[model samples]
Each structure stands twice: as C-alpha cells, then as structure tokens.
Target chain A: MSGPYGTMAEKVLMKGNEAIAEAAILAGCRHYFGYPITPQTEVAAYMAKRMPKIGGTFLQAESEIAAINMVMGVASTGRRTMTSSSSPGISLKAEGLSYLAGCDLPALVVNVERGGPGLGGIQPSQSDYFQATRGAAHGDFRMIVLAPASVQEMADLTMHGFDLADKYRMTSMILADGTMGQMMEPVSLEAPEVKTYDKSWAVTGTDCKRPHNIVNSLYLVPEDLERTNFERYERYRTIEENEVMYEEFMMEDAEICIAAFGVAARVSKNAIMAARAEGIKVGMIRPITLWPFPKAAFKKAAEHVNTFVSVELSMGQMIEDVRLATECARPVVLCNRAGGMIPSPEEVLQRIKEVNGGMTK
Target chain B: MTTQILIAGFGGQGVLFSGKFLAYKAMMEEREVSWLPSYGPEMRGGTANCSVIVSDAPVGSPIVTKPDVLIAMNLPSLDKYENAVAPGGIIIVDSTLIARKVERTDVAVYYIPATQMASDEGITTLANMIILGKLIRVCDAVSNDNLEAALKKVVSARRADMLDLNKKAIELGFNYAD
Candidate 1:
C-alpha cells in the first residue's frame, strides 16, 4: 500500500461503481450491457467510456430486461459479459437472470441496491437481501453472491466474481449498496491471470467440425430435467462448502457478537471498536459472501457467546440467516434502519450496551 | 495522527472535490485515507458534503458520524454541522458567505473569507480551494508543499489554466488561517 501507487499495480482513486467497471475490464469482461440507474449509473457510464477503447461492447440497453437478455446473448458466445442495475431494475432483470442460470451460462450481474419494494427512495438500503440471497425468480437456484464492504472490495470481489462464475458456469452477483457504490477510495487492480475454462459447451459456431452445442433450459423429459436440477444442486453444495467467505473482528472471548455484512458491517466495526474501548466484550462477524452465509462463523460465535445481534439496513432480513446459522440456541437480536436511514455508531453501541446489560443481569 | 474531516457546501461549489483534494494529499504521504460522499438525491443542486479520514492506521469506517474537523463553505453547512464537530476539534467556516458565529467554546474556529478572496482573484469557483488552504495551514494535516502537489494532480487538464489562481487562493488562506 506504501510507495508510489504506480506500476505493477499502481494505485488509483476510484468510486465503488467505477471500480467495479474497471475491475470488469481487468477480468477480461469485454462486453457490457446495462441501463443507467441512480447510485449505480456510474458503472454503466464508466463502461460506456472505457469499453470501446479496449475493443469491447458497451451497449446502453433500452431497458433492464433488454440489458440482461443481451447479457444472455453475449454469454452464449462464451465471452465475459455483464449487466448492472439498481433494486427495481434488478427485479425486471430477474426473469433474464433465471433464464441465464437455467441455461447454465456464466455472466456477472451487479446490484448496487437502493431503497425499495416500490420505488421507495434513492438512498442506500439492504431490503433486497431476500431478493439477492434467496432466489429472485421462480424456481430453486442461487447465484454466487459477493458482498463488498469497501470501494477496494468492490473492485476485488468483481474480479473474483467473474472467475467464480466461469469456474462453476453459473451467474454471479456483486451485491453492493448505494453507500459503497458512491464512496471513493484508493484501490490497486491487477490484470487477471490467464485462467481458461474449457468452454467447449458454448453455443459457438461448430462449423460442422463437431456436434452443435445447444444452450437451453428445456429438458422436455421430466427425468432429465430433474437430473439437471440435482446436478446443479450438487454444484451449489460444493459452493456452499468451499466458497463461503467471511471476516472476523475481535471475536476471541467476545461476550457479545454482531453479525452483519457490507456497509452495515463497516458501520458495525466502528461500534465494535468503540465498545471495546469501554471494556465491552463485543466482536463482529462480517459475511463477505452472502449466499453461502458463513454458518461456521456463527457457530464459532455460539461457542463463546449466548447473545448475537444482527445489524442491518433492512428490518431484520439477514437476522434469519444468523438465527438459522446459530440454530436459535442464542438470543439473536436485531438493530436495523429501514427506508435508507443509516444507524450511527452510537446507536449500535447502545444496542450492544442493552445486550450486555441483559447478560450481566 | 488521525484527522477526520467533513467538507460541506452547495453541490456546484466543489464540496466533494475539496474533500478529494485532502484525501489525495494524504494518499501522497502514504497515510491511510478514505473519501465518502453524501450522494443520491441530496447531490443534485442541493447541499452536498463528503467525509474524509486520514489516519496512520487503516480506516475503520468511511462514514464519519462525528468529524474532528468541520469545513463549512456556506451558512446551511455551518448550521447543519457546527455542533457535530467533536470537542476540541476545528471548525473552518467561509466567513464571506456564512455570517453566523459558531457558539461552541470547546472547539477551535476559523472564519476564512474564501468567497470574497476568490472573487477578488476574479475566480469565484476556487473558493473551495481557498478555504482548503486555510484548513491544511491550520491543521497541518498535510504540508503546504504536498497540498500544492496534490492540487496539481486534482485540477484536470481541461481547467489547467486555473492552477495559478488556485495556488494564490491557497496562499491567501494559508496566511489568513492563523
């Protein structure tokens, strides 16, 4: 991080949205199709300017649905492709996303979420937790979801997200919020190493040299459909077992644990350190990947503490995952702010104090 | 040392740019830094603000609920953030625009007539840079030389013509801060 932020990974100041776009370029994502939306519009704007320079396609699709369908088209040819949108826009693309997942196509979908159920507000919100983590469309499938806390992680996770998608031949998402999307920080980006996947399965022109690769979700036979689903599920299990990513902060012998992710986790760290200053045995468990929730981290917390707090921007959406992860053995409490309001560190500290008082009593 | 600063003003007044300048200066010195803006609806022709953190250690949260330095470029900004400055922190105000006095006695307050000075230089847009001059001079967050170097990097080639005036503005505030 020191020395000149130049050459061999020169550091540059970039916002989270623009960083994601830059990382996409570095990760060999040459095709970009997205509609502009508040908070996340910078990603598309960045792509529009840079994509053409690098011999890439940067199409501003007519709509979110068109954008994702374009993603499907580009991904079919086996080149790295991506689309980005906000909450409401993401909802529209859900159908296209399902089609991509169903066809076993690898592509990147970025959701820099805003307040919503309707058009709610343009401020930051994690209300889309259920939409992003659980299946967004009709059917049973999960995309590889990476939650980035900082602008740096916004870039880092994007690079890794594309890799994971191609490795598993499944769609991957960079689930970010309005806060991280707009914030600026210094980030170092490196070109992705040559990691080629055997894309013999792509619907590229066979030229009659080999059998045609048919990419479709339709397996007319019920048995074949069920087998395809089970096979996908098998891959999901491997992802759950191996692709789980999380971070621990001051959890050793912590009397109280706060489980959160993304911006909430960033805010929680401020409170955790403040609580430690007051001699409160508080720690944090930050889930880096939301889908494969780090159940083991919660289990680790369960071994040390009986009280767990879920800090989030939504009304206890992620708290359910914490409860299930910890098996309801511990009292899982919630500290949240809905409708784009962010909780101050003092407020989080008050919650920690309340939980600590109950423990002492 | 850790300097948590909040710079606030109108959206077109270079509020975020001022914060970015401070952040880049810190980055040049190899100090840990973060710059987070108040985005969304609030950024459109309304009050815009950004939080900047420069620390010897890695930054914990880019969001600053209570900043050690509050730089107010307008009266509305002063009204919104005057009391939020931590006790014993510094409050730098643009005296030409904001007429209200900060009533807090625990914090150090400096009133720099940045707008008047920039207008005197015939470039009203550089008011933010003028106030920025007083900030680094007072806080020593970054050396004047490094701040000047960072200024060179931040002002893009499109507006390369304004660099000298910006330097003059910085020197004016630097002399006026103490």
Candidate 2:
C-alpha cells in the first residue's frame, strides 16, 4: 500500500482476473487479444465487455499464437497491448513472446496458470514456474516476471507491469495462478493517465515528419544478431539489478524460512502465522519478481534461518532456483502439490516442524 | 473474531448469491471478507457451494477448512459439509429439502422449511433469502440496513418486482427464527 505505485482509489471487492483487466484499462492499454482458457477466461470476458465501452480493441484471437502476434502488431504502434492465457496457451505464445522481446517492444502478458504438463485439470497450479522464469520461449531473452500473491497484487502488478515493460522496452508478465485469478478480495485501483512514450522505434505512419521505422525480427548476419543478443542481455542485467522485487515477513531471529510466490505464498503466510503463534520462529520471503528470483533476500535470510522450504504447486521447479540462490549454503526442502491441488497451510506447517526437528538432530 | 460460513445447494438454488450477499454485507460494514466459490465442473447445474469469511483482521487464507456456520439448502450439501463444521458451529438446514437432522450434538442446529415458506408466500425462489434472514438473527455479522443495501446492489433493476417478495421473505424468516 506504500510506495510510488500511484494514487489508488477507495477499496472495492474485485476478482483477481477482472482486476487484472481493469488495471490494464487503467494503464491506457487499448488493445487486448487472447484465447479463452479456464480460470483465465474471466480476463477475456471482462475485457470483452469493458473494452468496447472504452473504445479499445478486445479481440478473441483465432489462437494463442495469433493473439500474441496481434499484441505485437498493436505494440508496434506505440500503444499498450496485452494477451493472457493459462500454461498451455502461454506455450503457444512462447514464440511471440520471444519476438516481442527481440523487437524491443513493450507488452504485458498475464498467465493465470492452471495444472499442466499436458492439459492438466482446470485447477490452480504453479507448475509453470520454470517455464515462465527460465524463458517461456526459445531464445536467450528475459521477461519481467511478477508473481502476485493476492487479488490486490493481481490488479496492482498490471499497473507496474506495463510501466516496467515500457520503461525497459521489453515484455512483462504477471505470473498468477487460478487461486489468485478466482479469489475475491478488496482492492484499491487508480486509472492511469493517457500516457505518451518516446516511440522512436515505433513504425508510426508519421506523415514524412521522420524516417519510417521498420519493425521486423529477422537478423541474417550472425555478427549483427550476436550484438543484439548481448545488448538485450545487458538490459536484462539492469532489470536484475534494479527491478528485483521481494517481500520479507518476520525474518529477524527466525530459524526456518518459507520461500514461495503467488498462491503458494498466500498458503505459506497462513502457515507461517500459525507456526509463529505456536512459537516456531518461522518466516517467509515472497518473490514478487520471478525473473530476478530475489537472491538478496535469501542471502539475508540465510544468515539466521539455515533451513528453507520451497513451497510450490509443482513437484520441484522453484526449489532449483532457491538452491541456486542460496548457493547450497542452507538445506533446502520442498513441500509441493501437483495436478491442480493446493498445498494447505496445515501441510506446510507440518513440513516446517519436521524440518526443524531434522535441524535439531 | 472471524466468522467462516459455507453455503451449499444445487446450482440453481441461489447458493452462490446467498454467499455473495453475506460477503457484500460484511464488506459494506468495512470488515475484511473473502468469498471463494467451488469452480470448474463441480458447479455446472450440479452441486454448488461457496465459502465466506468475515473478520476484523486480514483474512489469512480464503479457503475455509472448517466453517463456523453451515447453510445447507439440500440433503447432499448437508451430508457433504456436515463434518466440516467446527465445534459449537451453527448448522442452518432447509427442512423442506433436507429430511435428515444434524447428527452432531456439540453444535447448534436450526431447521427452517425455507422452500415451503417461500412457496407458501408465492415466491418459491426466496428460500435463500429466508435462510439468510435466519442467519442474520443467528450470526449478526452484519446489520439489517447493511444487508438491505447490499441486496439492492445485487438485485438488478429488471428484477425490481421480486425485491418486495424477497424483503418479505427476509422479514418472515427473521421473525420465524426460534
């Protein structure tokens, strides 16, 4: 609630997916192209009704592939544009996300993930952690991946996601789950101003006022392509240095730390609260940006809590990130639930106690 | 203190709407409230249910594992969620559809023939409202003025004709609660 985010209005209950759409609208996003997918169709549905009223383009593209292309087309005109989907649908748009990152264009992508490896049930799952954070598409590119823990974050992240995409001239993704998508909570939202950007790279139909800009993603010369790749990686480094967002809860004097993001983080919060109530000295570090992975928070937490639990919906994807972040300095554990099942707070609390017992031995 | 409630019935029986009304009521009172519905295949003309949590502090988890109050419109919902009620929890059952009684002796049970009450009043769909009225008497999570304001926001203008009937049903249930 504090920071230079923006002026938020009074509180009102909004669904996470609907709030995402509303935030996109507030951020002056006039174009949205997405395919219908469970747990995330609400994004398209809300856009379908709201966009027309605001004179925005809300098209249900033929497919996820087509939707991302439509986003590319819209983004090239110096306007905010977005596309949303679940895990499978995001995979379909992986190539386009690569293209978006390649062209140095700004775009927002929302993935309200459902269970998956292949058409997993339409239940909340964070199985796409590796997919979203480790490069959703085939390329050496990075996206500003934001993981929202609540419906309020679902709305607020869309505002910041667009700004970060435009600020860095790259793609930003709101990595949410079906739980955050379907859950309802009080949110205070503010409408963004009619924004203008330095679109020197945009191929605007400028009436010969300036030279026409060509927007394409083809690099034949290997030397030229390598230069562009290195340039993009430099920008990624800046994002990693400056834009890594994370949250630390009750870390001081704590012996056990829970590292999670999004819905899993919400589950962990409840478990941490219960553990603290029972005198367990447990804490949590929630990664707001999945790309940067908040290694600094882990470093700070490792000074006290030598044991960490990577709570996730997958068997173990983020656990790898935690291990690499801590550099194996601390013993890392996993408490996971796959195939659309959510890990309850009690289950996570039990894991904390078990890990604590192991530490004593 | 936090009040966790579960409202369940067939999909067409206004199960979700009743939960939403309570959630909206809590929100109007500036209380931290969360409403979570059982989504996906479980809610397509089949059994539908929702969890509503109202608290003074921030709600930690939206999923209600054990409910402080259970509003069951039919037999199956009662059978399914009966065991999930906490000790001393209140079970409000629609006697019109559920013939079985609450088996737990630790909890208080209030049986209301909501459907029959609505049908007798010539507004059979007001059963949810009737049960809500009884809940207001038992829980007192929100005041009547707040509940009415929330109902007005929920009811569309085209359904204006049914508002009076719903009000009557709510009042009747409120007075009939024993």
Candidate 3:
C-alpha cells in the first residue's frame, strides 16, 4: 500500500519489532530505555545496534519499571523517548505507566505480547487484552492502544503512537504480539516527514530565557488533581471521537458476525471465507485500534446480525467489549484458545455452524 | 487476492531466507506483503517457521494459521502443518530429510529432493531457494520475473559473488518435473 506521502518503490526486509524501532528512530525518538524480553528482544537489540550510529540514546534497563521511568525522565524534557517489553514485563511496568498517565507525559510503550497471566508461554498470545485495554494499573487513566496485525502496521503504528501520545499528552502503546514482533516483512525505509512539538511545557534545563517549568505527578491538593483528571478524561473523549479504527468484511447481509483482532483476525478471516463457501452468511469485524473498542461499528452490525462470535487467543477477555458494544442486541459467543495456541479456521467454522443451528447465547 | 504461506525447517535450513525472498517478490510486484519469523524460545532448538502473506489488498493480519500453501523443509514441519493446508492447496516437501509421506489427498503434494539437488548444483545453502523456485513455478504464488528481481535485490546487497550459484539453484528447482 502507498504510504501517506507518495508511492515509493523501495523495499527492505525487517522484523516487526525491528521495524518499530526503525520507525521510532525515524520519527525523531532520541532516547529509548528498555529491558529485554522474549519476542520483543529484537526491538531493544535493534536499538542497541543502531542508536549509537545515529547519536541516539539506548539503555538496557535493570528492569521494566526502571525502563518506563527512564522514558518518563527523558520525555519530561520534551525529547521523544520510548520503551518496550512483552506481556509479563509490561505487567512490571504498570506502576510506571500509571505514573506516566498521572503526570500526563507523552511517551510510547511497545508491548510485543506473549501468552500470559503470569509467566505464560513465550509464543504469541492476546491474553494481555484486558491489561492493555482496561488499564492494568491503578487509577482513572486510559491508554491509547494501537494493535498492528502486520509488520507494516507495526512500523506505522509505532510512529503513530508517538504522535498520538504527544497530541493527547498521555502514554500510547503499540499492542503487538510475538507473531508480529518476530515476523520479517518487506518495508520501505523512507523516513516520515518530521513534525516539531511545542516544548513550552517541557522542563528543559534552566538555560532557557523563560521561567523554569516543573514536570510532576504530585498534586497535594485533591481539587487540583481532580481538575487534571477531568482534563485527561476530556482528551480521551476526543480521542474516542476521532481515532477509532476498524475493518469490516461482508457484514452488509450477514447473519453471523465474527469479532476479532490481531492474529485472531487472520484466522477469523479464513473461517469467514470457509463458512461463506459452505453457504453460511458469516462476516468479520476487526478492530485495528483496541482502545476505543469500535463500539459503534459493532452496534451497527449487531442490529442486523443474529449471532456475534468473539474469536480470540485469550479466554474471553475482549468478549466483554463485544458484549458491551452490542448492548445485548445480539447473542455474543466466545471461541478462544489460550496459552500460546491459536484457534484454527475450522474450529471457528464449526462454531458458526453450531450457532447457525440455534446453539447460541 | 492474496496467498499466505508458512515455510518451516531447522535453524540452518534457510527456511527464513526462503520466506523472505517470497515476501520481497510480492513487494517488488507492488503487492501488500508481510513476512514474520518464529520468535521467542522456538528459535532455540524447536522448529522455526516464517509466515509470509502476499496480497493485492491491504493485509489485515500477517499470522497464517491455515495457509494457502506450505513448504516443509523437515519431517517435523510436514507432520505439524501438512493437515493445515487448504483443500486444493499446495505442499512442497524436501524429500531429502522428510522420510514419511503426507496423508492428505485434498492438496497437491510435490516431494522434491531439494537438498540433494542443491548439493548436485554445487551449493548446499541453495536448498531453500530451490524450494522457493518450485513454489513459484507450481503455485504461481509469485512470478519468475518478480522472484528473480527479488533475488537480485537481496543477494546482490549481501552476497554479490554468490549470485551465479543462487540463480543456477533457482533454475534447477524451477525446472524440476514431477
């Protein structure tokens, strides 16, 4: 597909995590602090190999907590910075993520997820679905989660995550999986056009002519913190209005609507095709942006579709959102395979056939 | 339309390189494509697989569970994924390592002596490339011209001196019959 700029014929082979790292560097990210983890180690490794070449900063942090705090430290100075990890590592960074959100700092966090509740399998898994979408940390904050199903999206979304973080003054996550992190794809190395940010609010060193700016999350006064919370909530509201993205397929006259995202979407696509071939009216709803949840799109389809099947690699985590989105307008059934296992298209097709025979809800 | 494929084998079998070449060909043809390798602990001793999806439309997901085609370079890969190929799909096997034959009759299976062919062609590393050549010829998943262009782009940038050997291996596999 042609990038937003123009049609460039150049192509290079890159892994998904490596592509995200390259995209971040091209997007003006000057500092990156990360701890190594399975599936996502390539992002840190790529940064380690290339950061010095471009005079950028790369640090192998002691832990994910330290890494995320380091990102906040660099970002508070108005310098673009990022950190990345896998599912369990992200759980460790949750405390720092909450602080970043409370402080309203703009930074990027890439989660190349693996199966998990604890130290789950090292294979690709969407078990972190609730952790990413519902805020695994404490507080009233919400994160902007961008789910990329391909290597190109992995690169593009990394750049977009940084931009959105800056625009909304919050943390944004590229919620990818091991499948995406480890995959190699052809990517164009063309750099995106750089845009400067307004650093007037940044706490750069006191060498500036203006008064010193303080970046902090500590608000001793409850009312002041409440105002800050309300402001952040308003920004999130704006994001919900303008940034929700989803892909629809054959939903116009479908009786069964399958909802999935990321790797599940690929399997569901094949299942939908197979089901259609068997004369079943099955379609798919894939949410590209997992944070906003694409409620309107699901609600619109639920009006006509009799069965909404939520297909995922997790045990019914995203199914909650599907149910909420459909508003109980239709029966939402869950078909999932967790712990590093991906659901096959035939399994999904079987579910569609069963649902077609009044075996639902 | 798009074709999603998974090519898998041992670490030193050039499985990843074969997948990369196919993805490169798709990109050169101006198609939307993605190639993903098996990450995490699987890179240790277990089988290694790379998923390559080449499509005319914007590819929504890069992971391939039910691939339209599969290229199995080892016995384990064939055992694991032989049944996953779609009906009327294509399965290209390296008979050099895989002793047992596939049981599925719904898909077309071609058992090529890729390792022996590459050895006969005087280059052992070209086995995967040879299999890729067969894939392009039988499935037409990618055109010969696009494959050659992609091979030039990848090999010239890294192994310029070995271009002749790689081309010869590709031709041997492309021309292999039955």
Candidate 4:
C-alpha cells in the first residue's frame, strides 16, 4: 500500500508486538522500560535488540510496576517513553498509571491483553476492556485508549499514541490482545514527523533562563488535590469532545447493530457480511478510540437500530458503555468468549439472528 | 484475491521461516502481507506456528481461524490444523515427518519430502524454503518473478553468503513438484 508520503512503496512483514516497538522508535521514543510476559514479550525483545542500535535506552525492569515507574521517570524529563505488558502485568502497573495521571505526564503504556481477572491464559482476550477504559488506576482520571485490530494499526497507533500523549499531557494506551501481538502483518516503517515539546515543565536541571521544574504527584492539601483532579477532568472533557474515533459500516438502514473493537471487531465484520448475505439488516460500529468511547456515534445509530449486540473476547465488560451510550433506546446484548478464546463469526451471526428475531416480535 | 495461511511444525523444523518466505514473496509483489509467529510457551518443545496473510486490500484481521492454506511440517501440525483449513482450501504436508494422510477430501493436499530434498541439496536448513517453493507452485499465490525477488530481499542482508544454496533449493523444489 502507498504510505502517507506516497514516495516509497511500503511493505515490511512485522509482528504486531514488534511493530509497536518499531513504531515507538520511529516516533522518536528514546526510552522503553518493560517486563517480560507472554504474548507481549516481543515488544521488549524488539526494543532490546534494536534500541541500542539507534542510541535509545531499553531497560528490562524488575516488574511491571517498576517498568511503568521508569516510564514516568523518563517521561517527566520530556523524552518520549513507553512500557508494555500483558493483562496481569498491566494490573501491576495500575498504581503507577494513577501517578502518571496525577502528575500529568505524557507516556505510552501498552496492554497486550490476555484472558484475565487474575493470571489468565496467554492467549488473546478483551477482558481488559473495563480496566483500560474505566481507569484501572484509582481516582477520576481518564486515559486515551486506542484499540488496534491489525498489525499495521499496532504500529500506527503506537506512534499516534505518543503524539496524543504529548498533546494531551496524559498517558495513552494501545489496548491490544495476544492475537494482535502474536500475529504478523505487512507494515511500512516510516519515521513520523518529529514533534518537539515545551520542556519548561520538565524536571531538567534549572538553567539561567528558567527556574527548576518540580515533577510530583503530591498535592498534600485536600483543596489543592481536588483542584488538580478537576483540572484533569477538564482535560478529559476536551479529549472526549475532539478525539472520539469510530468506524461505521452498513448502518444506513440497519435493524440490528453490532458494536465491537480490536479483534472482536474483525470477527464482527465477517459476521456482519454473513448476516447481510442472509438478508438480515445488520451493521457494525467499530471504536478505534475506546476511552473516548464513541458515544456520539452509538447514540446516532441507536435512533434507527432496534438492537445492539456487543461482541468481545471477554464476557461483558464493554456492554456497560454501550448501554450508557445508546441510552437504553435499544436492547443491548453481549456475545462473548473469554479465557483466551476468540469469538467466532458464526457465534456473532447467531446472536445477530437472535437479536433480529427478538426485535421483530 | 488474497489468502491467509498458517504453517505449523515443531521447533527447528522451519515452520516460521516458511511463513516468512511467503510473506516476503507477497511483499515483493507489492501486495499487503504479514507474518505472525507463535511465541511464549509454545516456542519451547510445543507446536510452533506462524500466520501469513497476503491481501490486495488493507488486511482487517491478522488472526486466521480458518486459513486458506496450511503447510503442516509435522504430524502434530497436521493433526492440529488439518480441520481448520477452509473448504476448497489447500494443505501441504511433509511426507518425511507426517505419517498420517489427511482424511478430508474437500481440500487439496500435497505431500512433499521437503526435509529429504533439503538434505539432498546439502543444506539442511533450507527445508523451509523447499516447502515455500512448493507452496508457490501449487498455490500460485504469488508469481515466480515475485518469489525470486522476495528470496533475494530476505536473504540479502542476513544470509547473503548462502543465497546460491537457497536459490538451488527453491528451484529443486519447484522442479520436483511435477
């Protein structure tokens, strides 16, 4: 496929996890800290092998917690940085995620999701849906979550995530699954246009031009902490207004709507096609940005659709948002498979038929 | 038309390398392609598989539950993935390692002695390339010119010295397919 520049024909075979690492480097990310875990170890392995070749720093940290903290440390210095892990490891980084939020640091965290409430299977799962969108960390901060269904998006979103993080002065996550991380796809490697940041707020040593910048999460006074929380909420409000991304297919005169993201969205696409073949009016709504949630798009589709089916690799995590977005105008149903198993196209089609039948009655 | 494939086998059996070759060939043809490997615990003593998808359009999903073709390098791979090939798909088996024949008649199955051919060519590591050559011939998924270009590109940086042996292995496999 032709790249953005259209100068060079672009095609390089890359695994999804490896593409994330490559994209980070291409986006001028100078530091990467991560722990080894199933499905997502390639992100670290790629960085370990390639970072030094490009004069970047790659650290195999002690744990996911330490890894995220290391990312925060480097990010506070106005350098692009990233950390990645699977489900359980992401849970370990939750506390650090809150710290990043409180301090308003720009960093990228990747969760190559595996099945989990706990130490789940090493296969792909969308179980982290709630954790990613609902702020796995404590407090009222919101994150920018990008869900990539293909390896190319895995690379593209990584670069974009860094930019968004810097733009919003908040952490951004590429919420993928084991399937994405393990799968290989054709990806083009191009350096993104370098973006410079205002490092006046960064904790670099004080020079003659400016006083020292303090990077801390501790606003000890209750009112001071509350003000910071409200400020962050205001930022999230701005993000929601501007950054919601969604893809709509065949929704023009649809009776039933299928809502999904990441791998589930891929399967849902096949199911939507099959349902259409069967003369069922089925369409799909795919959220590219999960945290912004694409509520407006869902609300728009709800005006016409009779039923909305949420397809995911997890049981029912994303359904709540669908219900909220659609305002219960339509019956929201879920078709899911968890513990590392992916939902089949047949399963999704079956649910669509069931929902279609219910709507007619 | 584009096809997504998974080639699986035991470690050191060249399953991943076969997928890489297919991906490279597709890329040389200027087609969209990807090659994903089975990592983590599966890489040690367990079955290893790599997913390769070649498409004209932007590939929406890289994960393939029902592959258009499967190249099974061992008995385990055959047993595991034989049922997963789509109807009217193709299955390539290594006769030297896989003992059982595929029971499904709906899909075409081609048995090649890839390891034996590679040994005959005095390059044991080229077994994967041998199967890849056969895949190109039977599937005709990519053109011969594209395959040559792909082989050159993949081998150019890492295995430049062994390009001649690899090329010979590919030609032998392509010629022996009759």
Best by DockQ: 1
- DockQ of every model listed? 0.70, 0.54, 0.52, 0.56
| TM-score pick, better of 1 and 3 | 1
lDDT string, candidate 1, A272-340, tens digits = 988999999999899999988999889878988869999999988999999899998789999999888
Model 4 stretches with alpha carbons more than 4 Å out:
A1-9, A359-361
Extract clashing residue pairs from model 4.
A184-B35, A184-B36, A185-B34, A186-B33, A186-B34
Docking class of 1: medium
* DockQ score of the complex predicted as candidate 2: 0.54
Candidate 1: deviation at residue A92, Å? 0.8
Best-first order by lDDT:
1, 2, 3, 4
Q: What docking grade applies to model 2?
A: medium
Off by over 4 Å in 2: A1-8, A193-196, A359-361, B42-44
Number of the top TM-score candidate: 1
TM-score against native, each model: 0.97, 0.96, 0.90, 0.94
Among the numbered candidates, top lDDT falls to 1
* Model 3 stretches astray by more than 4 angstroms: A1-6, A186-190, B1-4, B30-32, B43-46, B54-70, B83-91, B99-111, B146-148, B156-158, B176-178
lDDT of 2 by residue, A9-58 (tens): 76666789999999999988989999999899999999999999999999
Tens-digit lDDT track of model 2 for B1-178: 8898999999888988878778878887878888888887765469988889898877777888789999999888999999999999999999999998899998999999999999998888889999989998888677777445777766778988876777787787887855
State the local distance difference test value for candidate 1: 0.89
